[model samples]
Target: MALAAFMLLLLPVLQGCAIQVTFDGASIPENVNTASVQLFENRAAYVNPVLSQTFTEGLKDRIINGSRLTLADGTGDVDFSGEITGYDTEPLAIQADAVSTETRLTVRINVRYENFKDPEKSWESSFSAYRDFPSEQNITAIEGELVDEIVEELTENIFNKAFADW
Candidate 1:
């Protein structure tokens, strides 16, 4: 009982010495306190009128919600600029009758990341996400929903690349 009491009293001191971990799992450098996200231009041949804005805003949202960095105007300690390079749909899962049972919609973005604090840590990469839907459904009817899903996935990928070590 005496040993138990001593251990219980030591717990608070041990807690004070424990390492703190952020719940978001972001591994951003301590000096990177601000970030900027440029409007992603739609350079794809098949342009979805709202894709550019949607993707840009989606990225901003992810950064704001997933990290402790502030969103700054122009360039910050970290900056992100990119363009939608490919937005295309291709037939998939063809049936025995030679007709596609599903169609795959893909959105690809070429991203350029700049880490002003450490230029060597910066990178340029392309990220893409897709969704498959029944071929019979008109794309116009489902495009918005599909695009939302794709944008969410793309934004997550970008966030992970920029902030998560893994």
Candidate 2:
């Protein structure tokens, strides 16, 4: 009887408070329900022909899966457009033998985000990510894997910036 009384008291307090949660902890405005992503052009000095399409799709997937936003045909409550700005490889982990043990491949992209509901919340930014592989290994052999991994990270970063208020 005492336990039942206690439960009943707690229920009233809990019911008075509203709680909501999301997998990605996004705080998007309630009015914004749709998003659009333009095809990203690969303008990097080292062009990856598929990168632009891959990134555009990756972001579209992220928005759809991570948030409540629908993919709009043209422009939605929020819009995203960008281009691949840099794709470069550099030697790393030089040894006493004067030989590089690893090569780091970096990808950079410039993104423009617009929130039609609230113009002040809109912004433009650049995001990048990288992967390192053994210098002895040929880039062609690992380029696909590295690019996929880097793109995943880049997409997550961009998603956080746009919706998570990061």
Native-to-model Cα distance after best TM-score fit, residue 32 in candidate 1, in Å: 0.9
lDDT of 1 by residue, 66-94 (tens): 88889998789999999999999999998
What digit string (tens of lDDT, one per residue) describes model 2 on residues 1-166? 9999999989888655533235777777767889999999999999988889999999999889998789999899999998999999999999999999999999999999999999999999999899999999999998999998998999999999988789
Model 2, runs deviating above 4 Å: 1-21
lDDT of 2: 0.91
Assess every candidate by TM-score.
Answer: 0.87, 0.87
* Weakest ten-residue segment in model 1 by summed lDDT: 14-23
Listing every candidate in turn, what is its Cα RMSD in Å to the true structure after a full C-alpha superposition? 3.9, 3.5
What lDDT would each prediction earn against the true structure?
0.92, 0.91
